[model samples]
Target: MTEFDAATAIGEGGTAELSDGWVIGEAVNGGILMSLATRAAAEALGAAGSHTDPVAFSTTFLAAAQPGPARVESQILRTGRSFSTAEVTISQGETATLRHTATFADLDANSEPVHLQEAPPELPDPESCAPAARGGFAEKIRILDRLDMRIDPATVGWAVGQPANDGEMRAWIRFADGREPDVLSLPFFLDALPPVTFTFGALGWAPTIAFSGHVRSRPAPGWLRMRITTRNVIGGLFEEDAVIWDSRDRVVAQSRQLAGVRMPSAPVSP
Candidate 1:
């Protein structure tokens, strides 16, 4: 098992080069790229004397990133006594790949807990579900090798040319290396699953336009259960909402993204 390292050395003028490993299809995974940018932003905030975790992160994808080296440029937007905001841009040479803005703050650990939302979607035990198929698609996307995913069999009809009546997917996911998840891993896991459009009988890639995630709390050590749903797909565009529940069944993070739905194309030869 290989562990994912999101480390970056603080460079002059808020610059750092991202390490390669995570990739999907012809591009690096969006979640991993977002994590890189977030790390650079966090480092910038710490340098400015602000120590806080990212509470809200929003990103807009300008272009797809390829494996190998990329540079991240971070700019501090504002720093308050309790919160800080920063923007990070990742570029490969002259081409800009991703831009992200994040807000950071120290959450109050002693705050009283309030419960209002209903329980997460019920699914069969992780052990009972089938592992995600890792054939042509997985081979093209090398990042699947780094994840341990057990998806609900019912949600996988699309894989066999059957469309799901409802656009919903459920899976239990964790790092293949078994590392405990943290705030930094939250965004990566949030976007780790396949696009919800697949369940709706939409083939081909659904490239994300913009994505945002809110980190509510760090996950406990164990598999992260995820439920992804799409309420609409129209005009070659769609919206996906993802909810992540920790081992303790607590909602740890929430994410939503807008993506362009491309029509299914002929299979590519490896």
Candidate 2:
């Protein structure tokens, strides 16, 4: 099997480079980019270990990426006792691709627990679903090939897929083409539940304004179910909140992102 360990260092400095195997498509997606940035930031901070979990990240897509050699540069803005902040610029060849910032913090005990407003969508047993893997690139966006998923529709309630990797996970994902997913693609997986709360009309086509995620604990290897909802939609901007649950149905991580309905054709400001 082709090997692409997120823990491995691809490169570092004001600029860095990394490599990933080609999946259904030549380009990378949100999750891979996030992992690259997270790894770069953790390495830069001299963090005790590979980011066991991601706390928060904000990425902007400047251009689409093609599979092959890639590079990432993580800039440490500040390091504090409780928290650290950094920025990452990802690119391929000479063209700049994506830039984003991230914040990491050590978990503390004093953090108060919050009440649960809603439960996650139930999913089918991952084993029941058939594995779908094709050799070449897919015509439409599909992330099923990279994972093991089961979709009984009526019985499962929703899609339940897990990555073949050791510990990392992504959940609540379907294919862009509406066909059963081919692999667990990162972008759509991370974005799936966030916009569910918004009436389809309220979620106008918009670019991501910002994204943030917090690591609660090291997630177990299994199909994690995620529930996403639109928290607020106002002033042409919307915020989506994501809650990820493990196989046992325990919340593991939470993420939030903001986007605006109207975006200029020009680059987004930092």
Tell me, by lDDT, which candidate is best. 1
Question: What Cα-based lDDT does every candidate model obtain?
Answer: 0.81, 0.50
TM-score of 1: 0.90
Q: What tens-digit string does per-residue lDDT give for candidate 1 at 86-154?
A: 999998889999899998887455112845543777889988998878887677767778889888998
lDDT of 2 by residue, 188-261 (tens): 34653313322332222345556666655434455656655564556667676777665555566677777666
For each candidate, give its TM-score against the true structure: 0.90, 0.61
Q: Which stretches of candidate 2 lie above 4 Å from their native place?
A: 1-9, 12-26, 47-53, 108-118, 127-142, 151-209, 230-240, 258-270
Q: Could you tell me how far off, in angstroms, the CA of residue 124 lies in candidate 2 after the best superposition?
A: 4.0
With a 3 Å backbone cut-off (N, CA, C), the pairs that clash in candidate 1 are none
Model 2: worst 10 consecutive residues (lDDT sum):
158-167
* Ten contiguous residues with the weakest lDDT in model 1: 261-270
lDDT of 1 at 211: 99
